[model samples]
Target: MRVLAAMSGGVDSAVAAARAVEAGHDVVGVHLALSRAGGTLRAGSRGCCTIEDALDARRAADRLGIPFYVWDFSERFREDVIADFVAEYQAGRTPNPCMRCNEKIKFAALLERALELGFDAVCTGHYALLVDGPDGRELHRASDAAKDQSYVLGVLTAEQLAHTYFPLGDTPSKALVRAEAAERGLTVAQKPDSHDICFIPDGDTRGWLADKVGAERGQILDRAGDVIGTHEGAHAFTVGQRRGLSIGTPAADGKPRFVLEVRPVSNTVVVGPKEALATAEISGIRATWTGAPPAAEEFDCHVQIRAHSDPVSARAQWRSGGVTVVPDAPFDGVAPGQTAVLYLGTRVLGQFTVDATVSAVAVDA
Candidate 1:
């Protein structure tokens, strides 16, 4: 089997490429350059697509004696992931750039190019499993639950899954991969994991957007619509954010208030008690399924709203191009533009972008 490994200059991907070689498959290493041009390394972190990372990937390929190359997809990445991220935020929604990268670049563009180049499959170091089910190829969470990345990959189509491989899915811990790299004398064995979003390395997403859109002064209002403070911009805030709000006045109950909503058009940040954050249902657009769409109109399943969050029990109902999910219990901080992944046991049922959620009803006296 011929495999094209997407090496991100990290220990996980390095080990993945090595595993492919050891499995007796012809392998080629490719590092995706997602940045426009060479930029200074962000403080305290070496993000992906850096010159150092490219060198590290080359060294790993040399150690494994495999063909290696760096593919510049910076333009496509900017259009699909980074630009989309900025646009969504400007519209007062939180977007997950990692998920966009996987859906657009890795699985769509890169996979298509790999097939055109005659590779049988494209491999990655994602901590998720691909298994052949009775229906077709199914994606599952990785062995390491804490590191499972299936949520971000929920947008993958069935065809993409058929030609993709996750070599590190069953690996119990990342520690094991580091140990293997040490044994193999790989250079990335001790490299710390990439932490910040590749494009926004300083972790100042607001700063990045402010530079792009120009900060606008806005009013910070309490739940009752009374102006409590002032903010630089509504885009700088997200639903349920508490810190950096600088609201001097306390809530009626003397508790710190949390941001409840960000209205872009109104340029307002609404604050309220934490209990106001609890929501019962969510609606989303752009829903996608792995295989055939479910036949049932509504069914019970587990739903995850954010990466690293435990799946919550919920009932899902599919609409025309969206889905409505009602969690068994109220969910807090269900933000718009976030992915809502549905799971049926270990398999990913489908996913959608959260548009809105149903407000909890008040009890009658």
Candidate 2:
């Protein structure tokens, strides 16, 4: 089998590409240049896809003795990942840029190109397993729970899953991957893993959004719709945010308040008690399955809302335009635009983009 290994200039990807070579697959390495800012350097692993990262990827490809190339996907990335992120925030929804990148750039765009070039699969270092189930390929959690990335990858469709390869999914720990990289003489063995949004390397998300969306003075309101304070912009806040809210009026009970909602259309930020963040139900659109769609319209599964959040036992139903999930217990701080990944034990059933949430406390009342 011919494999296209995505070398990200990181230890995990370097090892993943090397493993693909060791497995006797005809492998070719490619580094994706997601940004045109070639002079930009990674800020101690806060961001990725910088020029230095591309160079590192080239070096790893050299060590592995594979044909290497850097593909310029900057325009596509800006349109799909970065632009979508800003637009989602501007519309008062918290979006995961990494999820968008995986869905739009890596799996969709890169896989399309790889297939056109006759590669059997596009391999990466993602910490998620691909298992051949009765129906077809199924996505599963990585063996290392701490490093499981299946939640972010839940957006993958059945077709995408069929052409994806993860070499590090079965690895026991990240330490072992680093050790393997050192043994393979990969220079990125001691490199720190990138975190936060890659485009905003400084880790100042609020500042970054403000620049993109253009912050304006907005009213901060309570559940009763009465103004409690003022904010620089609605885009700077998201549901369940606790700190940095400059509210002049304290709650009646004198407890701290949390951001319950961001209404971009109204240019208002709603603040309330923490309990208001407990969501009982979630409704999502843009559903995608890892393999076959569920056989039943209604079934039991585990729903995970965030990359690191624990999955909650839930009942899911396929509705007219989307899916609805009712967790056995309330999920704290679920927000619209978040991805809800359904699971049956370790197997990922599918994912949906959350469009609405019903508060558990409100429902109970």
- Number of backbone clashes in candidate 1: 0
Q: State residue 279's C-alpha deviation in candidate 2, in Å.
A: 0.3
C-alpha RMSD (angstroms) for model 2:
1.2
- Residue 161 lDDT in model 2? 93
Name the lDDT value of residue 75 in candidate 2.
Answer: 98
Error of 2 at 75 (Å): 0.8
Q: How far does residue 245 in candidate 2 sit from its true spot (Å)?
A: 0.4
Q: Report residue 155 deviation for candidate 2 (angstroms).
A: 1.1
lDDT of 1 by residue, 93-137 (tens): 988888899999999999999999999899898999999999999
For model 2, how does the per-residue alpha-carbon lDDT over 1-365 read when each residue is reduced to its tens digit?
99999988989899999999999999999999998876878778788898899999999999999999999999999999999999899888889888989999999999999999999999999999999988889899999999999999998999999999999999999999999999999999999999988888999999988888798998998888888899999998989999999887778899999998889999999888899999989998989888877889999999999999999999999865899999999999998889999999999998999999988776223
Candidate 1, poorest ten consecutive residues by summed lDDT: 356-365
What TM-score would you give candidate 1 relative to the actual structure? Answer: 0.97
